[model samples]
Target: MLLPTLTLLTCFLLIVTLLPISNHTHWLIRGLDFPRLQIAIAAILLLIFQLIVLEITRPSSLLLICVSGFCLFWQSWWIVPYTPLFPREVKRAEKNSQKPSLKILTANVLTPNRNSQALISLVKQHKPDVLVTLESDQWWQNQLSVLEDDMPYTIKCPLDNLYGMHVYSRLPLTETETCYLVEDGVPSMHASVRLSDRVRVRVHFLHPSPPSPTENPESQERDAELIVVAKSIADSAQPIVVTGDLNDVAWSETTRLFRKISGLLDPRIGRGMFNTFHADYPFIRWPLDHLFHSEHFTVKSIKRMPSIGSDHFPLLTTLVFSPKAIPENEGIDASAEDRSRADEIVEKENVSKSEIPQPTAHAK
Candidate 1:
């Protein structure tokens, strides 16, 4: 009984460590930002393996442990594709007194979550120039209507499905386009708003469901959509900001690639990775929400707001636009070779016959 109880305790510890691994996998499969989750899982796995070896001694139980270890090791491969190990520093851009400006906020209010009051409180407190919400239903739409007086400019598409999205802006919206980047009905909101100085800034709000048996066959579509957006931003000369519950993490390979491809900067690097999802489970959380920007803006501050009933914690960021030129090496500069390699990877991943890449032997 002592040995059995010890084994059970060991197994429980291993399982607890593995649960975050599963959550990280779920986030990655969904094309969401969740690198912190991946890192936590990696740390936990390291500790678990050490404990397993120290505690298990019986042959039958050891064999069972070994098998479980093998499966756990196998699962690490899913995380291998997304890990962002490179350290990136944030360098504040020189402020220019001449430029017009804009401020934005993005959140994913989990539709079933009844924390409408908490969410409302957050909105009232922050008072961002623009507010975008995903997973909004009619009820949420109604609940959020109180903000119409302040955020008079708005575009709402609330639905019963969690995918219902909305955008409200304080700036004058010159044009707005609702685009379907991947699956039908999964819309991405795009708008051009005139800032206080009459400068136009392009803002895009996206929330694509990751690859899952129920939501998608694979993550290829989600990845491709992100890549497409990256390509568009790369081509644009305008100051652009992309914000939403990206369902991806700041440090993931895909996000890094997206930043490189789109010439965008992340506020998290040099600051901190603000883990936003699974608000109820502080020990097992990751940053699945994000705001990526072009070089025209410098982040003043960014933070994770208090839990507002949803599985995700709302993210608030304040950025000041600066016409200051980015130092040659400080900004994203994907060379021709890099772009070619990235394009090939994207193409391969999007191919219908392709299988998700397996974890390397070293990763295991």
Candidate 2:
């Protein structure tokens, strides 16, 4: 009974594992991309039980063994970058460079989670140069306003909807704009942050919509919003860092496309998962928040912080501007086909207002 049950479970998991291989934008298909880590764990456990404990050497068992092994390898390959076994994507910041560094702290406060003390404590503990919070409402804004004294430069859009966002920075922020990138209610921030007289960096803070039954039924708009930002920027000269709760996993095809199109490198790659969502659930969580940067910078440190009474945890990343290190990191650029697909997403003619959002980028 146990052996037959195990085989059936293995087959079912395989189907879910392979479904996202196709470029389907449906919520169900895209949603499957989030659990690659969990799925890989399940496959490993099944393989161990079959070979070591169960030891059922029948022809059917042999087929299950092959399938289970393939699934494990496939998932691992997708997530290998997050493990130390893989080489770091962005080189570490060198000590002697002594370049100016910026520490950014981003957290999705889950809106209704009234406990601002945890987030406040984290900000005080880390003393980040920049602080960003998502799913924040007017109340949250009022609660966190205490940070204004130190982090004077601020950009805020506090809506009742789940997409409201706020950004606070200690450095001088110029040409800051609050934009409705794809959805009317969804807002994102773009600005130039001046680190010093000789050094300034372009920063984009985004909290794009996710594919879910209650929200977007498909991933089209979400994909389009990210592509718009990626396609608009030039990576070679200007130093750029994109951070926030992207509402998508780092390993998803859309995010990979964003990296290729924008020529940005993920610091989290070759680091760790830094899973930041579903803070209450141990078995179910994903790296929904992200920080991606151009080759002009090197990572000092990137980590996931402790919980703050919200459904999501905080992410802290410190980067030093070091254009010389650019050559050490391999750049990922979009192929001709990748550009075409990105064009289709951003400029699809048949898209509805709700599904296709015109990305607004400006300086004020």
Model 2: per-residue Cα lDDT over 1-364, one tens digit each: 9877987988888998899998899999999899999999999998988787564577878888889999999999888888888888989898766788889999999988999999998998899999999999999999999999999999999989999999999998888888876778998888888877787888889999999999999998899888888876643357788899999999999999999988999998888888998899999998999999888789999988999999999999999888778789886777899988988998852332233222332221
For model 1, name the residue pairs that clash.
30-210, 31-247, 32-247, 32-248, 33-247, 33-248, 33-249, 34-249
User: Measured by TM-score, how close is model 2 to the native structure?
Assistant: 0.93
Query: Each prediction's Cα lDDT score?
Result: 0.67, 0.86
lDDT of 1: 0.67
Residue-wise lDDT of candidate 1 within 1-364, one digit each (tens)? 6556545655654555455433233433334334334444654564465456555565766655564555455445434433344344344444554445455667788999877888778888888888889999899999999988988888788877678899887777656777665667777777776675545677778887766667766656666666667776776667778888876666555667688888887767756667788888877777788888777676666778888888888888877666564452155577786587457655754532122111111100
Q: How accurate is candidate 2 locally (lDDT)?
A: 0.86
- Alpha-carbon error at 125 in model 1, in Å? 1.5
Highest TM-score against the true fold, candidate: 2
C-alpha RMSD for every candidate: 8.9, 3.4
Question: In terms of lDDT, which candidate is strongest?
Answer: 2
TM-score for predicted model 1 compared with the true structure = 0.73
